[model samples]
Structures are given as structure tokens and as C-alpha cells.
Target chain A: MTLYFMTFILFCIGMYALVVKKNLVKKIIGLVIIENAVNLFLILVGFRFDAEAPILEEGMGKMVAFVDPLPQAMILTSIVIGLGVVALLVAIAIRIYEKYGTFDISQIRELRG
Target chain B: MIELHIILFFMILAALIAVEMRGLLNSVIALGAVGMGLVLQFLLLRAPDLAIVQLVVEILILILLIRATVKLDRPSESTLKENWAYVLCLLLFAGVFLWFGYRALEGLPLFGAPEMNVSDYYISNAMEQTGAANIVTSILLDFRAYDTLGEVTVLFTSIVGAIAVLRKIGRKQ
Candidate 1:
């Protein structure tokens, strides 16, 4: 229970860093932290105490030993998506840095509307 | 377990606020954070399929963000309170939504009987009807193919928009 709340706090902290901090790398890192926190939370959601892999074979009938496999499968997809988003964001970050010569974010100026 | 989701929700809201601040990088990070929290929420709701779809979209968004940032200079911070009234109005709208959400969540009925679930209808026959082991795939590609087609069309349109916007940059690079 406490762990769950702590994870949430970690997420909030990451957001704070991403929001209030001016460093580009730190902002990216904060984004990573946020993504990781969510991934952790998802894992925790499907977690069952002392549970085994979800695969069911012969002689496992009526056995309550398996945790859910659905979340893991979903997590796999999410991880892939996270990779893509991270890559795109990083690429954009690099471009912004080149154009503005600074990562302070407040210094970059072209996007309106 | 429930507490976990509530905390993630708070985290998401905070991240949203953070992104709305004066830094472009911070806003991008906040966007990612919101995505993360949304993934967690999907997991809690037992909808892994939606989580995966959203996750994939986030990756593309990150790429687009990075591309734009690299191509253009960052916007200068405007300290002037230009949108205070709009922000206040948005806050009032959010309050209404929050109250509505609270009421909806509180009124959810308990489900103890599997026989009462409409999903059971699909659970038993989805594979047979759609020839897909993944229920989400079956529903997406079979039962809801029209909507899926629409989504694909939207994707194609976005790709066109990207090309149109980046054509000049492509020539330079």
C-alpha cells in the first residue's frame, strides 16, 4: 500500500522536475522517470503475491498459481511505444538545442498557436 | 491497489500542470508523464489493449516533438498574464468534470456473477468468429473494423501533413 503511494509521489516529483526545471537533459530524464513510474505501477497492478507465470500447461487445472499475463503483454506494447516517443522527443530536443544553442527552453522561440 | 491508481492520477494532474509552465522541454516531459500515468490507469482497468495502443502513439509523438524542436528556436517565456481569464474558465469546467467523475465512480455496481456479463458473449466466441487469439485484435479488426479504418485514415492524413510541413526541411537537410 505504502509502496503504491510512494510510486505516485515519485511520478509527481518527476513531473515537478520536468515542469519547473530548465535543463533539457533533466527534462528528458524526468520524462523517463515518469514513464518508468507508470510502467512500475502497471506491473504492480497485475501483481499477485507468490504467483507464478501465467502459462497454463497440463496438470494445472483449478490451480490458482498464475498471475495475469494480459498486463505483461500490454506492457510489452507500451514499452515499445515509450521507446518511439522517447526517440522522437530526443530528436526534437537535439534540433531545438541546435537552433537555439541553449536548452533552457525559455530561450527557444518559434512555436506559436 | 486502488490507492495506486489514485496516486497515479494525482501524478498525472501534477505533470499536466508542470507541462503548462514556461518551458517547452518541461512541457514535453510532462506530456510523457501523463502518458505513463494513463498506461497505469489502463492496466488498473484491465484494458491492456488500450494501454498498448496509447504507448505506441506516445513514441510517434515524441519523435514529432523532437523534430519540431530541432528545426525551430524555442519560444521566449511570456511572463505576462495573458490568459488568466481563460485559465479561470477552464478551471471551472474542470471542476464540473471532476464532480461528474466522482459521482460516476461512486455509483458503479458490483459484479459477482460471470453469467451476467455481456463480455462473456465475446469471451467464448471471439476467436471462433474472428480467428484471432487476442480478443482486442479480434474486436478491433473484426467487430470494429470501420472505426479502425477511420483511424488508419487519420494516420494517413497525419503522415501527409508531416510530409507537407517537413518538405522544406527535408530539402535543406
Candidate 2:
């Protein structure tokens, strides 16, 4: 339970950075941190104490317990998604810097209407 | 459990340093440390698959971030003040989220409990159904194949988009 709360706190810290930071790269870092926190939370939620990895070995006896594999699969997908998003974000940031000549969010107000 | 907590503490500390650091290179390195901590936590949680994926992804992200920021000038200090209004708003949001999150968590099973019906089915029958020893691979490739397909598509689209954007930069130069 404490671990869960700590993960949430980490997530909130990421949220603070994402919402308040001015640098585009810092915001991207925050976004990745939040993604990781949530992934960690999900993996933690599915953990089983004293459980073995979710693999069935040949000639093994009937298993009474194995760690949950569903969340692992889901998190795999999510991690890949995060990778794609981060790559794209960095690309966009590079282009933005090329155009605006700065990485500050406040100064890139051309879209503000 | 104590070990887990220690790892979490370091993870959070790394995140804080990453967010507060002035140099982009140092910040990126801090974030990579946080990712390493997370990979360790995943291993401690009995998720070797996740740990492997996280390790590779973290390396990839670190490379991308360093490549993107290497030639760029150091970012100017932000002028946005950390005022009371920001703190109050963040506190309110955190309070509401933690309250509701705790409430929701209470209704669910505790850590390390086999309480999820769907997961139970998958764990019990995956080997027999798919003839795959690794339950995670079976779940990803056999049971939830459509989702995997969609994820691949998403990845491909992002790669194309990144190439296009970077190509534009080259053309402009």
C-alpha cells in the first residue's frame, strides 16, 4: 500500500513538471516519467509475493501460482507506445527549435489566438 | 519490501533531480537513472519481460534525447514563478486524485493477490490453449493479437512521422 502511494506521489511530481515547466524537453521528460510511473504501478498491482515468473517449463508439476501476465503484456504495449510518442515529441521539439529559435514554451505564442 | 521502498525512494529522487536540473544533458542522464531504477523495480516485482523491454526502451530514449539536445544551446532559465496559486492548484488536484485513487484501490484486491478473474483464466489456460510456455507471449500473440497489431501500426506511423519531420529539417537546411 505504501509503495502504491509512493508511486502516485512520483506521478504527481511528473504532473507538476509537465504542467509548470517551460522547457519543451523537460516537459517531454516529465511525460516519460509519468508513463513509467503508471507502468510501474500496473506491474506492482499485478505482482504476487513468492510467485515465480509466468512461464511453464517442460515436465513441471502443476503450478499453484504464477505472477499475472496480463498486465505485463499490456505494459509492454504501453512502453512501446511511450517510445513512439517520445521519439515523435523530440522530433517535433527539434523542428520547433529550428523555427522559433528557442525551447521556451512561453515565447512560442504564435498559435495563441 | 524494504528493498522495494529503497528503490522507489531513489527513483523518486532521480525524477526530482531530472526535473530540477538546469543542464539538459544532466537532466537526461538523471531520467535514464530513473528508468534504470524502474527496470530494477520491475525485476523485483517478478516481471522480467517488462524489465527487458524497459531497459531497451530507456536506452533508446536516452539516445534520442541526447542526439536531439547535443547541438542545441543550453535553455534559458524559466521566468515562471512557483507562486502560491500554482502550489494551491497542484495541492487540490493531488488531494482529489489521491482520495479517489485510494477509494478505488480499496475495492480492488491487495498486492500479490490473484483476484483478477480475467488474469486467472489467462494464467490457467494459456499454456493449454496456445501451447506457448511463456504466458505473456501467448497473451500478446494469441489472445490479444489484435491489440498487438494495432500497437505495431501505431509504432510504424510514429516512425514515418518522425522521419518526415526530420527530413523536413534536412531539406530546410
Task: List the global CA lDDT of all models.
Answer: 0.55, 0.88
TM-score, second chain, candidate 1: 0.72
Model 2 C-alpha lDDT per residue in residues B47-111, reported as the tens digit of each score: 88888999999999999999878888554643444556776898899899988888887886787
Query: Residue by residue across A14-101, what tens digits does model 1's lDDT show?
Result: 6655555555655665676676666665556555545444433345444444344444554554455555455545655565566567
Model 1 C-alpha lDDT per residue in residues B16-56, reported as the tens digit of each score:
56544565555655666666666665555455665666666
Q: Give lDDT: candidate 2, residue B154.
A: 96
Give all TM-scores, in the order shown.
Answer: 0.54, 0.93
Q: What value does the lDDT take at residue A63 in candidate 1?
A: 40
Give the CA lDDT, 0 to 100, for residue B58 in model 2.
100
Q: Which has the greatest DockQ?
A: 2
TM-score of chain A of each: 0.85, 0.93
Worst 10 residues of 2 chain B by lDDT: B73-82
